[model samples]
Target: MPYIWLLPAMNKNIVLASTSTLYEGTYLDYLLPTIRELYQGVTEIIFIPYARPGGISHDDYTARATDFFATAGITVRGLHTFDNPATAIRNAAGFFTGGGNTFLLVKQLHTLQLMTALKQAVESGKPYLGTSAGSNIGGVNMQTTNDMPIVYPPSFDTMGLIPFNINPHYQDPIPGTKHMGETRETRIHEFHSQNAIPVVGLREGSWIRVKGNRITLEGALTARIFEQGKTPYELKTGAIIPF
Candidate 1:
């Protein structure tokens, strides 16, 4: 009856979210090592490099992912083939979703009917990690994502392993160029105009992680939680979110 299937803290499973562009992902060095410490360590890391959409060809995508994991000393495999997404996911000692376009990633997974499978695999007592777009899908819905809906993804069904919707790259104020982007606060407000779901604004270099009922905030500064009537509130480490 649970919308999400998360193994308790006893399993030692966790998720690391990155909402920044992968090309600018310098924080991996900081996060990956901590992921290794969770439950001591993991055997292998399976990379799900499927968020690029049509920006790049599948072969190129796969090749790029294969090479990235090579440096980590963790055996890596690309699971972009739609025919058997769940198979590859289930076999992973742990999962990492690289940053890209969350909308594209969600659409592809839904279209291929792999969203549920990805969700299942991550919650199956193994470490499931996501960066940028990869991290966005961990939440209940994809509205927090910044990617445009260029392609017709299969469904809105993302991994949904995490309860609160995640707005990766979340920032209170937009700094420089304005190409007309939606703020995390604005988007969540929009999402709430219809749905009453709680949302977490996770800035770059930060993550919201849950182990059993205890959710912890990591990385820089703090995270913000937003709901309909209430004003967005700031949270530091060790804070328990109502979501």
Candidate 2:
């Protein structure tokens, strides 16, 4: 008789993309190749579409994922399809939360009372993926998001899956420009005035890959790290996040 052995213990696999669309192509073009390995054995993905980019319907958002994942031989199911979102999260083999308005996304999670369940799933080593607004809520709070308060959520708190906050689509100051607008850095600095948590400024084309206790920078672009009372510094690709 042959014995079936259990899989070896592995770290929690998490992908937090800065944005969904790249300048060159469709959604998740850059990460598609690498996604297969990160999501090994995951034939189904639970798609969370509460963010509703440009007010897109949940079905449309789910279809976007379905179209993309179909090529990978995976099936995508929207959380909205299930009668109980909490139960869906609890039983999900893997998860993918799309990009959109952070306020809208957070509000829906709280209203549905699935925030805790989602966090529990991620913490329990479920393969989790997030982009833009989805990545924003994976942090300590939604205070760092660039979007305005189109709608107010019951709380600014988030899943806290990661210890720090994330500011996606982070832009640097333009050279010799006269706009005189507050730069992304300045806004983050203002946020630091009240909050002591670290904030990562993830520019487009960059991302954070979390494997249990380690988070390394990925992509061609460098990410800016904003620590309380310290000057922000750039982290090169492959650099382990130093919190």
Model number with the top lDDT: 2
CA RMSD of each candidate after superposition: 3.7, 4.4
Please tell me which predicted candidate would have the highest TM-score against the true structure.
2
**Residues 1-243, model 1: lDDT tens digits:** 454433333353566565433345643656755565552456567667778645776667666655655555666666765467777777767777777777677776777677877676666677777777887787787866777777776566566666678777777775785758666677788888988778888776777676755668877668888887788899885566666
Q: Per-residue error at 213 for model 1, in Å? A: 3.2
**Tens-digit lDDT track for model 2 on 1-243?**
232221111356888989988897788878897678778999998999999999999999999999998988889999999998898898999999999999999999998888889987887788888999999988999999998789989998998878899999999998898998899999999999999999999999888898877888898899999999999999899999887
What candidate 1 gets wrong by more than 4 Å, as runs, is 1-12, 20-27, 38-41, 62-68, 81-83, 174-182
Clash counts per candidate, in order, are 6, 0
TM-score, one value per model: 0.83, 0.94
Superposed by TM-score, candidate 1 places the C-alpha of residue 35 at a distance from the truth, in angstroms, of 2.8
Total clashing pairs in model 1? 6
What C-alpha lDDT do the candidate models reach, one value each?
A: 0.69, 0.89
